[model samples]
Target chain A: MQALNQILRRIPVWAVYLLGAIPAPWLFYQGLTGSLGVDPIEALEHRYGELALQLLIVVLAISPLRRFLGLNLIKFRRALGVLTFVYVSLHLLVWLILDVQVPSQIWADILKRPYISVGMAGFVLLLPLAVTSNNLSVRQLGPRWRSLQRLVYPAAVLGGLHYVMQAKGFQIEPLVYLSVIVGLLLLRVPFPSLLNRFRQVDSA
Target chain B: GVGLAGMARGAAAQEALEPNSWEEITSYNNYYEFGTRKEDPAKYAHTLVTEPWSVKIDGLVDKPGEYDFQDIMSEMTVEERIYRFRCVEAWSMVIPWNGFELADLLNMAGVQDGAKYVAFETAYRPDEMPGVQYPVLDWPYREGLRLDEAMHPLTIMATGIYDRPIPNQNGAPLRLVVPWKYGFKSIKSIVRVTVTDVEPPTSWNVAGPREYGFYSNVNPNVDHPRWSQATERPIGGGLFAKRIPTLMFNGYEQEVAGLYEGMDLAKNY
Candidate 1:
């Protein structure tokens, strides 16, 4: 674990950002070349959203990975968060510009559809976290920034819900995403303490 | 994606209706028996042995027998039809289908007096169909239509696309094509078509009763529980194509609206 951390430290945070940027453009190139199958727009949208969820899971795993396994790769969490936001933004743009082009329908969908509504809400929550995912904001806000970034918990859950809701039928993929997100969240909160709190609440 | 013919150009009004090329019509379809993905059907459906296929047409039919594919083709008068195929998943395709009307097929089978609905079932060969291994909406995918809807001139039992034998992925030897309804209602690779008194359970409706209804008529006014079915992105339009407003009864309202007279479409939906 110590050896792994030493190697991870040697790799600069910019490396994470650079590596993260690759998938988005690679996906775009695939879409542009007509390689992303019959419906490129839908494929691109799903890919971007899935990538965002994947990164979110990774970011969520960091703390537990360090606390439980002693594999500290904390320096790259911000980069992962920013990259997740980038994919999320790309997914939204594809839906807005390419998939659902009508201006009226955009607002209607976000307002009316629970899945879209939750997805938009998740995006909104991520907006501030993304903006503050920097060295300057980290220094200025200190402990408060950590609290603000914790908004990812609800955002991640919403993102998973959005995925599950949008799926046509009972698809295992989306449910797996939601379960992983919830599982990671449960890992973050101490299980025994949570159980005790729940018991106390029940007794009260 | 190769061999894609150029854009659907409206050259002449009749010739203008040539919306999709042979490649577009053959590839990119939802045959869940093959797999759920659009490409899955084209990839996996090849395993299906379409040669010497037969359909067991029973239930209320006087001539209830396993009709051989070749014999059915020889008996029926096949014709070309350029129809707009709309999926429940908000995607559209213009397919040049070659088949005879379902009405003619039903008449040949001799629709008995008690026949109220026609329930169609897709072939569920787990060995041929890798997707049937997974319980994705009950195996041997089923779909149904009202006796009137089934007998509609527009309701065709498509055997071919682009005047060629229908590819295994695109339902091969025989399939249903009710243009007025969503694509799922047009069950693919049909083996059994039963005419009965009761409204038989459809695959999608059976799976997600609230989301997918029995009468899945393309109505822009009626919204899906999850998303608005008001618009659909045409498949041939490529990536940059914007979604167009979904037409009522998929532009077959003139022909099919009379079928649902005095019935609340929204309630049924």
Candidate 2:
């Protein structure tokens, strides 16, 4: 267990990213294979979307995880967030390219559909967060960086709402992810100073 | 009541007067793609391949024949019937479908005794079918009905939409098009039909049983667990349009209500 933890602790952030990308090629191959069972395109689109939501939750949980469990997954935060963006972009692409097909219909559908409108809102909110993910941007706007990252909280909620509204029913699975996001966000608020200091010192 | 029947007959008569065009038929759709977006399926499903088809009729049936595209459809009289397809997704499409009545074809099949329900299955193969690869829905599309429901006059096995042969994506060659129920109940691109004694679990129902029932009648009162079934926006109205109130059994309650007597839809659903 110690050796395993040590290996996990030492693995570079980029390695985690590369590992995540490993599924993209396989999914693409599956998309071609017709082995995706029932609805291949929808399957791929959903997989990308669901994983993106999961990664968003994971990224949101990082600070709280570090603060609570002394597990510094800080190195993975940017990569996870970026992967979330990558998947979200792919999700949007599938909707636009395969589902929408016609340009005029796409415009009208997005404008008219409330779920699509909210879903698009979530994607748009994620854009600045994705674009400004670099160290250069963080360094350039040091004070603003934290505030900008805060967009993820509402983005996650909006995304959850978008998915819920789309399903048009109470699907319990997505609700669990939403709960995790809420829990992680709740954990980040200023706790009792003694407990907070204790965790900080323990981590140090 | 007498006038309404005359009006319906008149409408049916007028339907025969002007055969629908392919553009009007193809553009209008009941597909639930685009997050159950009514208008999206016709657009997205253009890439589907509907040719080179065969339907396998098995299970409780005696013959269990593997029917080709030509053989099953060869003898049946094709007619243009304009139907108001009300989806469980709360959208509607008035399609001028070109196909024979399902009862005419089922009679040809010679259904035997002990056959209580009729189950339909779609062609399963995802390579040419990109939609199959997505687990967004359970694969090998399916829908089922009690034998009485299967034999209803309005139950049609459609081969074409909008006067032209059904586009490959729209369940070409043959598809079950029950006008009264939600779109999913009308299983598309049908490759299999079985007369089964047991109630066969269907695709969407298997995906989420509480939300999708086997007998998916178009009742506005019995809402899908997630969305209201009270209203549906008819297709061709484009965006920002008014949705007419959906009728019980899609306005076929008078004809089909007898089939569900003594059975509570709320529990059965």
Candidate 3:
């Protein structure tokens, strides 16, 4: 496990970016070749959304991994975040350019549909985080940068909720994703501090 | 010579219509009875018992009884029809169906004067259909049409596709094919055909009345609450293929527009 961690740490962030970009071309190829089944556009769109969510989950897990597992993958976190944003932008673009071509209808869908509204909210929240995910932003913002990047927590929750609402009927897959996201968020909570506060309250 | 001329005419008619391959038609489906996924019905519908089928013709019909599948087929004169099937989800397909008109079946049963609506029911067998185990929809999916719409010559009781028995996924034994309405209006695996004095409850309308209505006529102008009805992607069209503009009544406006002449389409939708 120590050797694996050393190897993981040695791997360049650019390599992670390269590996993350592989699925986009493959998906496009499948779509072009008619291998994406009956409704390829819908399939492509779904894949992009799922990939973005999976990447977001991985991004959320990075800090926990470094603290608990002794696997420092901090260098690649920004690359993963940027890749997640790229996937999310692609997902939104697919809906805009391919699915709903008309401008008025697209606007109506984003405004009217609860799922779309939530998804757009998540995307908007992620936009600033993606833009500021750099060494320069980190140097400039200092302590404030960490607080700003925490927006990913709400963005990730919204992303999960968007998936749950988009499903036609009661589906277990989206619910499972939501549970995992919630679990990840809960792991970040400072339980010791909360317990001390509770003890103080009881004494008072 | 007359038979040869008739064959030639049939060939010409088929040539004029957009051809949907047998593979595409067989694989893609939206039968919720088998499952919610589009391909679920095709994957899981093999368990369905279709050979020993019967349709229960009840309610206000004069000759109300359970009609045997074989008997119904023997009595009817079947013909091939090429139709454009539009789904409420804004997708479409060109299907070649072989069946007799619904009017013929209704005429056989002898419709009662008081009957104003034709309510249809899909077969519900929990043991065979795994989807029925879940309340994805109220079991035994139901759909209805006005008596006039039921009696229209364009509305057919489809038994076969591409000169073969309709696949289990595409509602084996018997199914209604209402060309002008959205695909859901053409209920699959029909087990009951009831002629009623009042409008009957439909599964979708019961589930989400705002999203699905009784009329469900194909109108590009009236968008579905969640999606646009202005355009539809043909099932077999490639991934990057452009969606075509959806037609009013799915391009059957001339034949079916008069049916809703006095009613407001948006309200009905």
After TM-score superposition, the amount by which residue B71's alpha carbon in candidate 3 deviates from its true location, in angstroms, is 1.6
Q: List clash counts for every candidate, in order.
A: 0, 21, 0
Q: What is the TM-score of chain A in candidate 3?
A: 0.92
Docking outcome class, model 3: medium
Task: Report the Cα lDDT for residue B250, model 2.
Answer: 82
Per-residue accuracy of model 2 over A1-204 as CA lDDT, tens digit each = 446547768898879899887877677677666444223455567778888888888888778776767667777889999999999998888766654445675676667667777788899999999999998999998999989988988899888877776663334556777777777778877669878899999999
Consecutive 10-residue window with the lowest summed lDDT within model 1 chain B: B1-10
lDDT of 1 by residue, B114-144 (tens): 7899999988898898887777777779999
Candidate 2 interface RMSD (Å):
11.9
lDDT, each prediction: 0.87, 0.72, 0.88
- Worst lDDT window (10 residues) for model 2 chain B? B30-39
The residue ranges of model 3 lying beyond 4 angstroms of the native Cα positions read A1-12, A62-76, A186-204, B1-16
Chain A TM-score values for every predicted structure, listed in order? 0.92, 0.87, 0.92
Predicted complex 3: DockQ: 0.50
List model 2 lDDT by residue over B1-269, tens digit each: 23333434754323333433454345445443222332355656765565667778877766778877788778787876667777676666567788887777677777888889998887776555544444566667678988888987778888887667877546666788887788878888788888889998897888888878888888888766555576665544332235567888887676668888999988776
Instruction: Encode model 3's per-residue lDDT on B34-100: one tens digit a residue.
Output: 8877779989999999979999999988899999999999999888888889999888889989988
Query: Judged by TM-score, which candidate is best?
Result: 1
- Candidate 2 CAPRI-style tier: incorrect
Which candidate leads in lDDT? Answer: 3
